[model samples]
Target: MNRFKKFMIFGALSVTLLSGLAACGKSEAEEKKSSKNADGTYEETITIDVFDGLANYMGVQEGWFAKIVKDKFNMELNIIAPNVAGNGETLYQTRTAAGDLGDLIIVDKGQQYNELVQAGLLYDMTKYYPGMKNMARFDEAVQKMNEGTDALYGFPTSVSSIPATSPSEGLEPTFGAYLRWDLYGTQNYPKVDTLEDLLPVIKSMQDENPTNESGKKIYGFSLFSDWDGNMLNAGKQLTTYYGYDESGFVLAKADGSDYQSILDSDSEYIRALKFYFEAKQMGLVDPESTTQNYDTLYAKFQDGQVLFSWWPWLGQAAFNTQTNLNAGKGYMMVPIEDQKIFSYGAEVYGGKQFIGIGSNAEDPERLADFIDWLYSPEGVLANSSQTSGSSGPEGLTWEMKDGEPVLTDFGKKALLDGDANMPSEYGGGTYKDGVSALNINTVLPIDENPENGFSYSYTLWESYQRDNTNPVLEDWSSHMDGAVTTMEYLEKNNQLLVAPGASYVAPEDSAEISTLRNQVKSTIVEYSWKMIFSKDNSEFETLLNEMQKTADGLGYQTVLEFDMENAKAQNEQRVAVSK
Candidate 1:
C-alpha cells in the first residue's frame, strides 16, 4: 500500500494501540483503570503501546519531555509505537472482534468506523458532550462526530477552525491538484480555468526541462494506488474534487442533480480521469506512479521526477528555497468550476484522525480528563512540536526566552536526528517512517494551538525551525509576488467547507448497503487504471461501460437511493448541529 493509504489504516491504531489494555479482559481492564485525582494529577505511570517498540524514544521514565508531561498532569505516560510501518487491518479486526480492544481507541473513517460502531466497540460519548474543556469550541468537529447518531463517539484531530495560512506559508491545498510554479512561470503564467487548460502548460514545462538536477526524468504528474483503500485509486480519489465521500461513493451537485455514482460519464472524476489518460498519451504522467509505494513516490518528489502533486505535503521535500523562492517552482491552483469543496476533512470526526475512550479502559473518567487535557492550550502546544518550553528537554532541546518557546540549535539537532538521546530503550529511530501525527501520544490534536491563525500558529507554534532553518513558506513567500495562498483563494471565491454527503448519513450499519458499497469500491479500483492508461479514448469508453455494468449489477442504484434517504435525514441533523 502507499504511505497515505497505510497511514489511513494504521495511523490511528498506532496512536491508540494499548499492548497493556489489549492483554486484559473485562476483569483485568477494570483493575488497570485509573481513578480521578483530586489534585487533577496521577501518581502512577500510564502505559500506551501505540508504538510497536513501546515509547522507548524518550527515557520517559527520566527523559525531560516525559518529566514535563508528568509534571504538568501529575501522571507519567509510557508510550509505544512501531519501529516500521505496515497495514494494520488484520491486527485491528482480530483484536477488536475479540473484545480486547485497548485502553483508548483511535481510528480513521470508512467502513471500519461504521463496523466498529455497529459492533459496539466504541464508548457512547453522550455523557461527556460539549463539556470536555475546549472541545465545545471546536463545534464543527463536535458536530461532525455527532452525525449518524444522537450521541458523539469520537473526537477529531489536526483541525483548524480558522485559516492556518500566513505570509509566505506553503499552500496546503486540501484539493489534490497542485503545480510547480517555477515551470508555470517559465511559460509566462497562463490562465487555466479548467482541467484541460493544465495539460499543455505541464507538457511544455516537461518538454522544456526534461530532467531534474539529479539526472532523473521529470514528469508532469504522478499517482499512487496506496492511498486507494477500499479499492479506490486516483480516478475516484479525484472525487475530493467534489468533497469527501464516506465511502468512495460520490455525488456531483453542480449539474442540478442529487448525489450519484461518480462512475457516471459526466462525473468530474471521469473528466479528471480522461485528463490523465490524455496526459499519459503525452508521456507526461509518471509511469512509476502506478508501481511505487509512498516511500518511493516521496523519493521521486525529493528527486524531482514528479513536477506536480495531488496532495500539498507530498511535494514538500523537493520544495527547498532555491526552487520555491529563487526559481518560483510551486504554487496551488485555484479551484475549478466543477470542483466545489474548499477542504475534505472529517469536518470534525472522520476526515483525518479520531479518538475515543476504549470500551475496556479502566478509568473512563481519567481518560476523559486526559482527553480534555489534550484539548487545552498546553496539550496543543506539546503535540504541535517535538518539545517546547516546559514541555521539552530544557537546554538540551528547547529553552524559554521572555516567556516564549524557542528551539535551541542543540535541541534542533537532536530533533532532526529523531533518535538522539532516545533513551537506550527507544533502541532505534523514533517509531517508523516519517509521517506526521503518529507519535507516542495516541490520537492527538496535531493541528491544535493557542493561536489565531497563521499569524499566531506559524510564527510561534508551527515555526519550521528545528534549529537552523525557519519558516520555509515564510521565506519563500518573501520572494513571491502577489501569490494567492489556499485560504485567500477560498475566501475570495466565497466557498463553504461543509461536511461530505456520507458524513451526513446515519452511522447505523446496513449490511446490504455495505455489501453493495464494497462491490462498487472493488470495481472502481480494478477498472480505473484501465481507463486512465487506455491506449485510446475508445478503450477508455469501453472500460467505463464495463465498470458501470458491474456497478449496476451489484445494485449500485439501490445503494444510492439508500444513501439519499439517509443523507436527507442526516443533513437535518448536520444543519441543526452546525447552529
Candidate 2:
C-alpha cells in the first residue's frame, strides 16, 4: 500500500479508538460532538501522537508546557516513550512499519533518518518550510539542513559552541583528553603537547603511583570500543591541526586535482595502527578498552582509579553527581601545551534534533503552524522556560525577571552555576549558559533580545584562554579547510591513516555495498586493535598491506571518487547559498 493510504488507515483506527474511549464515559452522540469549531478552524479536538525524549527533562504530558500547547493550539498531544531496552530508534522503526507513525516525530538518530528517507515515509518539508527562510540568519549548518537532496526536509534547533579559550590557560587540551586536575595538580602535571608527551604521564601513573585499591596500576589513559571512543582516538592520532579532509577525496593531493586514498595507500594506515599498538603495549591504554563500555570506564574514573580519560567536558559533571569520588578533590581538566584543542562544533549534520510532521499527520497545516509557533520567539521562550505547578511541567519560561525570561530555577541553576569543577549536588550548570549566543547560531534577530536579556548567551571569554579574535570564516571556507586538510595530510603524512569511512555506511544502502563496507571497516578496526594490543609485535607492514588489498577489493577507489564529488557539490552549493 502507498504510504499516504497506510497513514489514513492508521488515522481512522486512532479516531475509532478515541471515540470508543470517550463513549465509555459519555453517550456516543456526546463523544461525537465533543469537538467544537468556528470559522472553518477545527473546533473539533485533534490529537497528535508525538514520539519524543522530552520526558527526560520535562517529565510526562502532565507538564505545564503540555497544557500551554493544548490551550493555545486547541489540540491534544500524545507522547510515546520507548522502553529502556528500546531506544527511540527501535520504537520509531516499529511504529513506521506498523503504519502507526505519529503525527509529529522527533528523530535523534542520524542513521534512522537516512533509513526513513529511503522508505519514503517522511514528509519532504521543502514545500512546507517557508518558516525556515528566517532561519538563514543562523549558522550555515542550520541552513544546510534545508538543502539536503536540494529540497528542505527539516528544521534544526540552535545549539551552542565551545569557547575559544580553555577553561584553564597554559593547557593545550585536545578532544577526548580529560585530564583529572584534582589528582594531577598544575605543578605535577605539565601541559602535554604531543602523543609522545602523554606516554611519560601514563607510565608515571602506572609504575610510580598506582592509586586504585585493587592494587592495579592506574593507566594514564583509557580508550573505549565504541564509535565515540574511535572518533576520539582517531582525532588524537591525527591532531586537529591536521584534520580529515572531509571534502577532498585525496589522501595526498597530486597537483590541484589528483587524489589518493590513505587506506588504499601503505604508510598512513600503518602509522596510525602502530601508534595505537605502542600505546597499548606501554600499558597506557586500558587493557579492557576493547570490551568495556562508557559506563564501566566512568565507574573507574569515579573510583579515583583514573587520573585521566578521554570524554566530553560534560562527563565531569555527570561523574561528580553519580559517583562517590570527591568532586573537588579527585578530578579537574589538565592543561596540555601547543595542542589546538578541537571539540566538535554543534553544527554537524545529523546532530540537529528535528520535529517534523509524519506520514500520519491528518492536519499537516495545523501541525506546521504549531511547529512554527514552537520555533517562533515567543514559542522558543515558552518551550524553553520552566513551568509553575509541581505536578505540571514547568512552562518553558520559569518566570520573567527584570523583563528578562529567567529559565526555570533548575535551568538557571544549571546554566549559571554549573561548571566542570562544581559538585553535582551544587547543580553543575546547564549547557545553556555555555552555549554561544542564539543570535549568532540561530536565525532569530539579534536586536530582538528577550526583554530580560539573552537567556542563550555564552560566556566564551570567561570559559577559555585561546584567541577568539579570528574572523569567523564563511561556511564554505571552513568546510573546504576540513576536506583539504584531511586529504592532504593523509597523502603527505604516510604514517597517519584514518579509519576507513565505509564502516559507517547507513543501513539503507544496497546489501552488496553494505556488506562490502562493513567488511572493510571490520578488517581495519580488528587489525588495528590487534596491532595496538598485540603481546608480540608482529611485522606491521604485512598486516597493513593485507588490509589495503581488502579495501581495494571493496572498491576504495570508487568510494574516494564519490567522496570528492560529494564534497565538491556540497561546497559549491554552500557557496552559492552564501552569495
Candidate 3:
C-alpha cells in the first residue's frame, strides 16, 4: 500500500477508538457541547495539530500561551517538531508522503515550500486575507509570494514595517563580538582592531576569571554544531562580522559589490576557520563544541562559563539577567575596528519562513481565524513577548503610562528574571516554559504597533530606555564616547553595512543542481569542522585543499555560477528598492 493509504488506515483506526470512547461518555459530551459560548468559537475544545519545521519544543503547547489560545479560540495546539521527532528531513518526507503535513503548517520559504505549493499541499489563504485586519499592512508581502499563481499559500514570517533602507535590528547588529562587560572593564576595555585582536583580550579575561562560581573552567568561545548546513554555521556566521552574507555557498558582500567562493583560501570562511583553530591552540576554545548542541552551549552561557559570543542576543540575553546587571556583570558589544558589520534591512515581505494552513485541515475557516489573529497586533504582542526583545501583552506584562509603555512589576520579573514563575491564572510554570512554542513570529518584534504608537520591541520603548540604566551599561557608555547603545555607536561611526531589503526570492534549483548541492554541502561541512579541530597547520591545509578539490569535482563551479547570477539579481533589486 502507498503511504497515503496507510495513513488513512491508521486514521480510521484512531477514529474508531475515539468513537468507542465517545459512546461511553455520550451525555457528558452533549453537555460539553451545550456549554459553548454563543460566539463563533466552538464550545468543544479543538486540538490543532501544527507541523512546525522551525519549532525547538514539541508535544502539547502549555503554560500561559496555552491559556491565551484556549480563552480566545477554545483550541489546544499539539506541536509536531520535526527536529525533535527524529531526523528532520526524514520526518518531512514521511509526513508529505502520508498526505497530511498537519492541520497547520510552518516551514522555511525555499525548495520545500515551493514543492508543497506545486503539490497543492497548502490551502489557498486568499479568501481569509480580506478578514485579516493587521495583515493588510503586509498586502504587498503576501502578494509577492503568490505572483505567478492564482492562490495564496501563506504569509511570510518576520515581516518588517520599517523602510526598506532602514536597518532591521534596533539596539545591536545581528552579528558582533560580545564579551562579559565586568571582565573586559577590568582590562580598561582594550581596543579590538581585527578579529585576531580578540585572542589576547579573551585570554586575559579567561585567566583572571578562570572559573564560574561553581568552579567550572570558562572558555573564550563555546560553539555548537546543531545548526550546521552548507558549511559550519558558526564559521559562516563569523563571516557576517566582515560585511558578508551567505548566498547559497557563496559569500556575497553586503554592499553588493563582490562575492567569494567558500573554497577560496583568502575567503572569510577560511579566516573564520583559522580564528577558531587558533583559539583552540590558545586553550580558549571549548572542547565540547564539536559534540555539543545549541542548548548545551546556551546553558553554559547562563552559568557564565563562556566569555565570547558572536551575537548579542545569544550571549547577552542568556547571561544578562536583572541580577547580573545589578551586580555590574553582563555581556556587551566590544566592537572590532576592522568590522563593517552586515545588517539585514527591513524585509517587508518577510524572511525565509512562512505560516500556512495544510490542505487536510478539518476546519479551514476556524484555522483561518487563528492565523489571522497571529497577524493582529494583540496576537503579535502575546505570541512574541520576551522573544526578540518584545514586551508582551499590554495589560499583563506592560502598561501604557503617561502616553508611553512601561514594564509592570510582573513584566520586569517575567521579562528579565531568569527563574520567574507565572501566576496560576496564567497557567503556572516558569516564564521560559510559558513562552510560545511555535518558534515562529508573523511579524518582527522590532516593527511598530499602530495601536500603541511604539514598536513591539521593548528595547525601543522610551520607558525601557529610561529604566535600562545599569552599572555595566553606564561603564560601557562612559568608555565609548557616552554612546548609550551599540546601535548608536555603529551608526555614529558609520560602521554598519545594512543590506537594503528587496522583494528578491532565489529561484528553485534544478534537480541536478540540487543533488550536486547536497553532495558539496556535506563535503564542505565535514572538512570545515575537521579544519577547526585539525592536529596542526599542515593537517589543516590538507583538509582545506581536499575540501576544495572534492567540492569542485562534485560540481562546485556550476553552483557558484548559479549563485553569482543570483547575487547580481539581488544587487539590482536592492539598488532599485533603495532608490
lDDT of 1 by residue, 277-379 (tens): 9999999988877777666776777666777776564564344333344343443443454455434332323233466666565556666666776666555
Please name the candidate that would achieve the greatest TM-score relative to the true structure: 3
Predicted candidate 3 versus true structure: per-residue lDDT over 1-579, tens digit per residue: 000000100011122333333223111211222333567666668898899877778899998888999988888999998766757766776676665678889876656567666555677777667877777888888888667778787888778778888888878778888999899989988998999999999999999989999999999998887677667888987798888988778898878877998889999999999999888888998899989987799999999999998888788888898999999999998989988888888876787677888776766667778888888888888886344777777787889988988998888888876547888888888777878888776887788898878998888987898898999899989988899999999888888998887746777777677778878888998898889888899999999999999999999999888988888888888888888
| Residue-wise C-alpha lDDT for candidate 2, range 428-459, written one tens digit per residue | 34333222111111211212333334433222
For model 2 the TM-score comes to 0.58
Q: Which ranges of candidate 2 are over 4 A from the true structure?
A: 1-102, 107-120, 124-153, 159-176, 206-209, 212-218, 228-241, 245-272, 298-305, 320-338, 341-354, 362-370, 373-515, 539-542, 567-579
Clashes of each: 22, 43, 0
- Candidate 1, residue 172: lDDT: 44
- For candidate 2, give the lDDT of residue 17: 33
Looking at candidate 3, the ten consecutive residues that score lowest on lDDT are 1-10
User: lDDT score, residue 445, model 3?
Assistant: 77
The TM-score obtained by model 1 is 0.71
Which order, best to worst by lDDT?
3, 1, 2
> What TM-score would every model get versus the actual structure?
0.71, 0.58, 0.92
The better-scoring model by lDDT among 1 and 2 is: 1
Q: What is the lDDT of candidate 1?
A: 0.52
